[model samples]
Target: MCAVAAVLLASGASAQSGWGGGAFFNADVFRADREAWHEERLVVQRRFSAGAASLEGGTVSRNGFTDPFVATDLYARAGTRGYGNLRAQWAPEASGVPRLDLLAEAYAVVGTGWEASLGARHIVTASSAATLGTGSVAKYVGNWTVRARGVATLDETIAVSTSLSARYLFDGVGGLTAPFAEVTVGRGREPVVAAGGLEIRPSWVVNGRVQREVRSGFGVSASLGYIWDDSLTRWTGGLGVTGRF
Candidate 1:
C-alpha cells in the first residue's frame, strides 16, 4: 500500500524539516517459484507552515515487466488538531502495474497522544479496477508509538486485513534512531507486492526495520520482511537514505 509508505514517511525521522529529499530501494523474492521483484524511487518534499507537498518518481520491475511511475502528495492541516493527505499516481501503459492510483485520507488527534484516520483508495490497471477503504489509529507513549490499521477491498468479494505495529524512538547525541516492528493478517492486499494482475489471497506478514539519523540532516533506514500467503512465501528487504535542509 503506497498509503502506508506515505504515512510512515510523513512521521519518520525525515519529516523534521522544511525541505527533504530521499531515495529508496526495495526487493522481494518469492520462494515458491524463485521470482524476484525490485523497486526504486526518488522523493522531493517541501513543508510549509500549514501544509506539505511531495513528488515521487520511481521504477518497478515485476513479473518480467518494468515500468516507470510518478506520484504526488499533498498534506494540509484542517485545524489545530486535524489534517489530511491526498495522493495520486500514474504509470502509463503498464501491464503489471497500476495505470492510475489515488488515495485520500483525513486524520485527527482524538485525545492526548492519540490519533485516528479514515481513508479510501482507488486503483486501476490494464485489465481491472478496484476500490478500497482504510482506517488507522495510533497512540504515542513517551518515546514509543503503537498503531493499528485495517484495509478492505470493496469488489465483488470483500477481503479484509488488519495490521499492528510498534516503534521506539531512541534519542541520542547525533540524532534519533527508531526501531520498528509490524504484523499483518487477513486476505487484504499488501503494499510490498503491488496489485497488478495478482488476486487477493489470505496472507500474513512480519516486518522489522530500523531508521537512524546519521547526521544533523541526513538519515538512513533498512528493513526486512517475511510474507506467507496461500500460494507462496516471500522475503523482502529495503534500504533508504534521506536528507533535509
Candidate 2:
C-alpha cells in the first residue's frame, strides 16, 4: 500500500496535478472469542475547478468482509460572495445489495468567527434496510477550533438512534493540522431472528476514538469500542496509518 501511495504521489506531482490514490488496511481484534479480521481499502481522489465551482470525486473499495463492496462518491461545491457555500454529494455502492445515498449541505460563514451548516441525507437500500438522517453545526474559537456533528437512523427493523461527535484542532503543535479525540454513544436494535419467531432486544453501545497527525500527509489513529449487551460484550481495537499526496 505504501508503495502504491508513493507511486501515485510521484506521478501526480510530475503530471497534471489532479490524480492521487492510497491504500489502507484495518484489522479488528474481538476480545470475546479472540477472533480477528482484516479489511483492506483502496482510495482514489481527484479534484477540478472551473470558475467559482469545484468538483471532487473519491472512490473506495473494501475487501476481506464476508461480501466485499465498492463505494464511489462525487461532490460539487459552488462558492458564493458572503452568505455561504452550497455542496452536494452522490454516493453509490455496488455490493450485490444495491444501495444509493444522496447528501446536500449548505454552510455559511457568519461574522468572521462563526459558521453554521444544515444538511439532509436520503438512502435507499435493498431488503428494507434502515434509513439514516444526519445534521451538524460548528463554531470556531480563536485560531484553534472545535466542531460537533450528529447522525440518526430510523426504520422498523431497527430502533431509532442518535450519535454525537466532537473534535478539536491543535494549532502549531509540531506542525500538525489537527490532533483530536471523539466519543460516541448510541442505541439500536439487533437484527437477529430465530426459527421460533423471537426477536432480540435493543442495546446501547459506546465508543471512544483518538487520532494524531504525524506529518504533512501522514497520520496514525487508534480506536476502542464496546457494547453493553451480555452476548455482545466484545471489545474491539484497531490501528490505522494514512498518507496523502
Per-candidate alpha-carbon RMSD to the true structure = 3.8, 8.6
- Give the poorly placed runs of model 2, Cα more than 4 Å off: 1-22, 27-38, 47-65, 80-106, 109-116, 120-126, 143-148, 154-159, 171-205, 210-216
Error of 2 at 8 (Å): 23
- Backbone clash total for model 2 is 0
Which stretch of 10 consecutive residues in model 1 shows the poorest summed lDDT? 172-181
TM-score of each: 0.86, 0.56
Residue 225, candidate 1: alpha-carbon lDDT: 86
lDDT string for model 2 (81-176, tens) is 122223333333333222454555555555454555556554544333334455545455533334455544444543444445443434312111
Lowest-sum lDDT 10-residue window in model 2:
6-15
Best by lDDT: 1
lDDT of 1 at 113: 78
